[model samples]
Target: MITEARQPPGGGIGIAVRDLKVAYGGTRVLHGVSLDFAPGSFTALLGSSGCGKTTLLRALSGFVPVESGSILLGGEDIARLPPEKRGMAMVFQSYALWPHMSVHQNIGYGLKLRGASRAEIDAKVTSVLSILGLAGYESRKVTALSGGQRQRVALGRALAVDPPVLLLDEPLSNLDAKIRLAMRHELKSLHRRLGLTAIHVTHDQEEAMTMADEIVILDAGRVLQKGSPEEVYRAPNSPFVAAFLGADNVIAGEARLDGEALAIRLPNGGETRMPAARRVEGDCIIHFRANAVHFGAGSTRAGLRLAGRITQSSYPGGVYRYEVETPAGRFLVDDERRANPGEAIELLIPTEEMHVFPAGMPSA
Candidate 1:
């Protein structure tokens, strides 16, 4: 479990969701989920389909009615408030821009609907256009803009309202790969400049890792883990989160306390000791990233060296991925050097790179 971080200077009040539960008719989508969004901090809600990430975001935005629990904004319960009444703005995945409206009109739509003076609406739109690098695009129809520009427009519209909290529901999923990567930095910069609380929902693990200050992993309507990206990646509490975060290499064995160290006994009569201090005993499973497995030419301390034969190989841009058969099991490895099938190879993995959990233990 991860604790809430400190608020940045000039940031808004923090948000707390206590035992939040939501449902759609007969079926519950969120089950007693709780979290705290630190003021001016960015949090990513990550999970697979039907994992209740979107449902949780919707509940936070007041778009979905809560079956139970309390949503406290600045220590005041806002669970019963309407979406518009809450001090929050949402940017949808579809860009949600009106094709017929010009960039300025679309950005200022909320202000107009709220009966702001024309001068005030125009002033806010102009400022947001410049902030989003759309100074000269105000008169252009949103349909004529590129995907990235449309994304900026949607973000600008959300910012024009000047809400305390920003809710993003897969806002970059529709953009091209290059644009999506670029927008990640842009969003981070915007969040810093505005000092607003942000909750982003994304199924893409890399996206969540790249943009979030904290990550919350959910599965089957329950939160499996919550922590900083590196913390969650390096010390995942369960097998599901380990695999979900790209640590796909799993090896099972029995572990026992060996004085100050944890030693694992493999089924094939091989043994290795981990540098961990925990005195865990019994059946255990080790999880590690594919790239964490180093082959030959690397110096890693307290590492396991395995002899294997390459069964398959493929060049995947920056790295060459290989499928190797070893005494432990078959697993994928990413290396900079190329090795052909049927070739003998050696691999090493540092003990600190492996995450160990008790087998058959359900996620917390």
Candidate 2:
């Protein structure tokens, strides 16, 4: 028996972090990271492991001490506040539920901690379980629930308190693929329905791209790029960002400006020209996705063409993936037409799909 959908405070409150820094003993994990979380917006902090994404989230939640800078929420600085006072609730990756506790007690634990009356706790727990589609399982112990159900209980616990902000630390990482996908949609729908400000930290690129309104790329404890998912994926600012976002095919070549395009000379005596919008001269590296490459020289589009031989081939489901040994380098290309190894072939890569950055740039 659910009454009405619960709304977060003020329909979600914005958060601002300014030059935040955090360290573990003598080692620094976050280096002056600054970000803004728009009210009712979902942002995903994306990075590789040990990139400090979790550290940043914990700092904002007051679980980690900030060495410098401030965390502002609703125009008030809450950097010094404890976790409970920050007006946020966190759902951990481990589904931090008590195995011995029933779903009802687990969901109402936060309310009880805040000194809420028994009747009030019961009402809130009932509403949460119903909203989470667990109405009849309140008396079931967490040990008897499936992973997905346990996760729902964890989310229920967080939502029961009605915090203005919701923080997720890879909460979907442990579930099976099917359940994880379903949970992604569920979380997104829930966030929209409740208009809650959410900050999710995950290393999965596809998960971030599909769920987040904004994606923040982090590396070595620093913010590398922040933009809409399409913006960052389509126009990465650096080679590291490009490679990290799935544009893994890389080529090294020399470039020189030629009118409106830059003529590139590959190591294997091949040549290509791409539009020049920036002052790029000398050694450079090019990046594109495996799917961006087209087989054969039949394409009439203007692009880079290279003659190569297929060194390896594999069937990774619907398409055949080939490793092409070009004069520039060994490149991965995905195509429907099957080809045997040692067979000569040509590759056509559209100019628009090429991401060129100066050589010696960071690849991580």
Q: lDDT of all the models against the reference? A: 0.86, 0.89
> TM-score of model 2 relative to the true fold?
0.94
Local error of candidate 2 at 332, Å? 1.9
| Residue range 253-305, candidate 2, lDDT tens digits | 88899999888777767677878846578999988987888686667877778
What pairs collide in candidate 1?
none
lDDT of model 1, residue 3: 17
The candidate maximizing TM-score is 2
The most accurate candidate by lDDT is: 2
Q: Please, what are the lDDT tens digits per residue for candidate 1 over residues 6-44?
A: 323346568999999999997999999999999988999
Model 1: how far residue 24 lies from native, Å: 1.0
| Per-model TM-score versus the true fold | 0.91, 0.94
